[model samples]
Target: MCGIGGIWNRDQKTVDRSLLQSFTQVIAHRGPDDSGYYFDDDCGLGLGHRRLSIIDLSSAGHQPMASGDQKYWLVYNGEIYNYLELTAELVALGYQFRSHSDTEMILAAYQAWGYDCLNRFNGMFAFLLWDSSKQLLWAARDRFGVKPLYIWEQSPNFIAFASEIKQFTKLPNWKAQVNPQRCYDFLAYGMLDHTSETMFKDVWQLRGGQYLTLNSDRQDADFGKLTVKQWYSLPSNQQDLSMPEAKQQLQNLLKDSVKLRLRADVTVGSCLSGGLDSTSIVCLSDQLRQESANNIPFQTFSSCFDDLRYDERQYIKDVIAQTQVHPNFIFPNANELFEELDHLTWQQDEPFGSTSIFAQWCVFRQAGQSGVKVMLDGQGADELLAGYTKFYAALFANLFRKWHWGKLVNELITCRRYQNATEIQRMIEPLLPIWVRQPLRRLLGYASETAVPSWLNGSYLQTLGVTPQVSAKFALTTPTSIHQLSHLQITSTSVPMLLHWEDRNSMAHSVESRVPFLDYRLVEFAYSLDDTTKIRQGQTKAVLREAMRNIIPESIRTRQDKMGFVTPESQWIKHGLSDRFEIELQKAIASLGQWVQPDVLQKIFQATLDGNSGMQGVIWRVISFSRWLKVFDVKI
Candidate 1:
């Protein structure tokens, strides 16, 4: 629950304390409670931290905390929900602690178990440990990507790391240079091709489940010498799954996950949207808390909008009634969001063009004001449980291509899937070759087929430097699921944008948000489960609903809609921003040399203003890239 920043100068030069201080200060919103720094002038290493006290509110919680023997110092962000448990295990192993702080637990754990400490804990986290004895640095991101970490390295004397990329702007030479291919990927797929790359050319996000180590003596920063190891990833099963067994396993894991996430010293609540994921989270979390005799009546939070077409407060009300959990509703206005946009984008360290992000932000703000320090959310459930309609759509595509029309239609009916919206038709009508519906489809596939043979194709290594497994996953649609479920990995343009919004919006209020369903184990298991478990007999999220049968409101449990924290964005753009959209769009076109095609953007703006928020995806990508270029000063 903090922002961390630091520098390691291989040359043993003193790091400018003011610079590190300045970098971290920019993210003070992330950790307003306290700030700390650690430096070893002789070792050319330094670490700085901004704290948002949660677990241990004592002075013992002060960070840049050191191991008992003082061999290592840690500047950590995020909570180790199992710290008390890990602490007991360490004490049994003869470890001594001076504080109840998880930071101390983290430092001690690293000292005792080395990098293996990651496997023994459960929580959202991103941390860096400076091993004074070895002059090496170790950092790890959480298993579920709930917390974010960024890294930058060049053949140089310095390698910088931080919880947010804006801290890197403190670098003397850092620039906002845009990566063209990133724009292409963002436009085509909504994210830069892989996890490691960002919109910026030099900075990279530490892919979740990966850790990195840098040695002071490595002249080139020796990326080869820098280990990027994954402690967690979805497991693979060569065979399909049994629905009954799958349901039981999902139920057990989910309950355990909710219980673990609820471990907090502060008030804990759940984010309940109209969607199955969040609703289920509220039900199970409230049930688990109540059964544990914790007597902690949890609070439920939901976002509100003037547009009831997209608002689902009724659904939230339904669940609250069932659980007796008091509900909090926050209404966000586009006008207020207009003012917060720049600061919000700065916190995210990139331009986020999604308006719905504002809705999530309002919820987080309300949580902060309600005096809640930690909130449980169903962030990863969609990815893990085949909860999105896009998954159904992709499954439909794969089945029809394999000529399994009966199976496709049956699953479609069971999932309550729909088809051919006017907007979708416009994009695909001409692009989808008429012959593709039949035997001629094979030829049509060749057009969108990537031109370069990826590492997955078993060729010479690629210039992109993406790993073979990563390249293969990119080549396949997405989700890295089994053959029958592979197509479900496809992320609509709005999905990635929404996730970015989620992270930035939540962190903006100094509130720690946790997502259990995204855990690699759960994700892999969900995908490996038989598709029937996810969508059965005209019900989406069937297995999840059954697991929470008596916990969630029966009305909501029976609801078929899967809309997430949706915002009535189109109407807002039309009534609140019509002039700004056109003026800015035209200006964007005028600077085509420094920007992307204005015409492409104008149409997206018009469509959205004309009351089609779904089209906001393409426009969101373009606008994000445009703003990123202007902010970063990328010439291309």
Candidate 2:
């Protein structure tokens, strides 16, 4: 809901007012309504904030706010959906407030419970709190990292934190330098934001469920030490529950999450992709609106395409017929996407996987143009509920490993009847030993996990000691259960990258995007359910369908095809944008230098253009990385 930045100069140099302002101003698109600043000359610390004014739009909501005793100064960049509830509790404890804002609630809570206050919060947030009396600085991100916090340490004594990495460019002595390992990871494995280390060298992010603290009053040896620690983590234990019990609990949790996210001063809407995750939110939100008698004319936004192969207009219409909602749609064309490629790349602050991100960018843009400030989206459901088809492989592996032939056979039949089941090869691939599978993949001309891509410069990667493989943090060699795979995806692989896209795309237009499904209570409960409850009769998110049986239209509740904000990347490469693709490909090969092989990449692009290959993802990476390098003037 806002942009926040700060400077902690441990050497005790007076913080420059203009430099702090520059850091906050660079990301003004995130918060354009108001700005605030605070300086502590004695501690050599300063905080800057750009306010979007979601919860309380009055001047009282202005940030860089101070506690009643003026002991703590806070600059925050997200919403605490439960702030109203927290305020009531704090008031009961005799705490007074000057502003009707969540910012004040946080200060009062911290004054009462200290760091333990984070355990009581249930929302998406990233904030910096300066304890002026103690000469201490505290920073923390939300449980699921729905908000972003980047840290740049020039040295142990001087550190800067911001909501976006672009703010670091405002530092006087800073230069943009590419991190080769991250570049290789994106080009070869399509990974971004998978770890704390970002694509820029020396720039790190505070991971989700984590916090950091710095004290200036310590001994010389520990003076500049920044202690980072985990504040929350997913529950490792699963709960045993009947199917009926699990469905009711999930429905209740989701409904409450949606209700909490709807607590905003500005206009709020939902992102409808016609898929189960998004449709469920829209339908539930409408249901809530009618029950509460809040007639603000609930609206929904979606991205559509003329190409039916890549469109979900039919399903979108189905939902509209069921709910009393006003629907808006945007048709994102390849020409428009290319026209704004540089801007979108700069907004993202790094290269992304595919044009699907452009589709999302268009959705947020449309929402902003329509005067919607906060939009609820469905992002975490897929990871938590095993919505991806690839999860089917993990389900089969779990059953086969346990030697449950009866269940395995029944699942295969159900899957074939209800789902595509075209990934049967992948479903059975996990059963093969690694030694045998590696050789078989090689025989099929497929690259193994350790094998470097032909288009990448193997020698350059070797010199940098960069192995072109998936991050071990996300790699599950052999997942024994859907829960294990869900844990990995939620923690490292999918949710982080998706959240990155969600934040940037929405904030680029000053829109606040919320993910109700990522509420800690809902995420924990979803993960605790049995795999059968998630994927039953071969349908993904089966429990969600049953929970919304009458709440949503039957057509949508039983829908199977999974396409959330999908774009026609392959079709564009072959038809509408072939010339542009070739031009960008050549520019990338020339500008990328030793990091890529020109001939190999050219052949790959040509193969895709000729409809002989399905390497659209690789092609887009090349185009995106090239533009990112130019947009930020990154030094290779």
Candidate 3:
């Protein structure tokens, strides 16, 4: 994977070559190996690229690559795992290749199928393709947005696209202004990356499964004239398959996905958290390696903690023993996190939810240091399957709505026995009336759909016309089945933010991270199965567990507890880093200005430190936002 950027002056003004180069240089870390530029002065368009040299190490892989006829120029990021297969098909269709790179495959496929080529691609990508003949610019992101593409429209005449938001800061007339609505959603509801609108005003992202086409031919065109369309969507169709049939299909799909992602010139490893999702990947990868007789001990990276409450060393050991793979570990502490907080916030390009992101950053850093260029992670599995504990409530609600009283009671008993699910109130809350559920949720310290947080400046929010309501996009209603809930999480709520963090963290270290579970085929297949296949017998990712039954160790395969990667944020805020956290909190309050009530925020922090409130997430958001403002010099 690499970094890509482009500028198209719709008014036909000459494109700034140096400024385009600066845009490319800003994200140099994303692709440190090489850089290239393509300029079309006649059309007032420039495309810049930074190469990480993953698939093809030769200069032949160099990009801002062109078609055989040189009619189309493309600046692309991300690897097409199935490039070989597509290449064979394209060659059969008389398409010739100059390089053994996925980048060339994209051009050939597009030439053969036009926009329909997006449906055939099976990888993470965010790319800009300029059709010189049509004077048309086409941009698209992957089906799950594993890659990032941000758009900045300075005016109708000036439009730019980049792999990261920070690239826009280098523009000559650019000023950093905060998008208040996104900021409010972040501070109040912990919502981010859920919509195309970003934290920066007038900047938007090309979301997953979507593409944009901008025609310079339009005489009076503006951002409104840009045609953005959804090319992919989650499959809502369900299949009636038996447990055995579903298990076998899932196992095959996951294995094939892993095999495809393994097609890389550089060394590839995995991020193993010792949870079911990650361990299953490690074991499957190890199995694949053995099958191919590639006995070089597969490398794995992990984040460990000394604190037992936050540690997964035991589970990590279990996987290592089973797989016999070379393992690398990093111990991330509060002090280290604080020291790198500013740099981390800058790398993320926006405020993150918790310190768990730091743990992940540490993992990628260790991998980069270990010379692993590509790391396969288990991110999309949880969202695609009903892996979160909160999903249990949705499962229960679905059963109740269907009048499956016997099944619901059995599930409740089994869940309590195996998973130790004690949130009886939440599990049954979905069955209650809206009026009853809202107050109960508030009492549990969860934000109601319409209740504004007391810490937020209500008057300031009103002035900005920003409503402080939690997004119901992922909410569980009476009709919301587990599949529907999973779909929501995958599309709008959880997976988007997770993928955002994954992309930024991995790319920050110049490492390509792949998620096999996010393969569209695997996602569709998983969604097609019944909900029981996902979370049966109190087991989350039940189908995956059963699929890897004999392949992975039974201990890890049947694990009910889930902790992908965690940091001791609450503990640190209360004890070791309390002073530093307090200092940052004060600075954040000062930086935030009227956006937050200083007194209220301070009380919340104090209560959290005293172990009287569970507002560490809020405190972290405030601190993260403050650092972001300073790093980007954003105007509120």
Ranking the candidates on lDDT from highest down gives 2, 3, 1
Off by over 4 Å in 3: 218-224, 419-422, 470-479
Better of 1 and 3 by TM-score: 3
lDDT of 2 by residue, 390-412 (tens): 78888888888889889888888
Better of 1 and 2 by lDDT: 2
lDDT of 1 by residue, 89-207 (tens): 98999988888788888887887888888888787788988887777788898865667788887446777888877788778877666654554455444554255677778888777
Please name the candidate that would achieve the greatest lDDT relative to the true structure. 2
Off by over 4 Å in 2: 218-221, 418-421, 443-445, 469-478
* Cα error, candidate 1, residue 198 (Å): 0.9
Q: Give candidate 2's error at residue 327 in angstroms.
A: 0.6
User: What would the TM-scores of all predictions be?
Assistant: 0.86, 0.98, 0.97
> Could you tell me which residue pairs clash in candidate 3?
none
Off by over 4 Å in 1: 217-225, 238-242, 292-297, 393-409, 412-499, 591-594, 607-614, 630-636
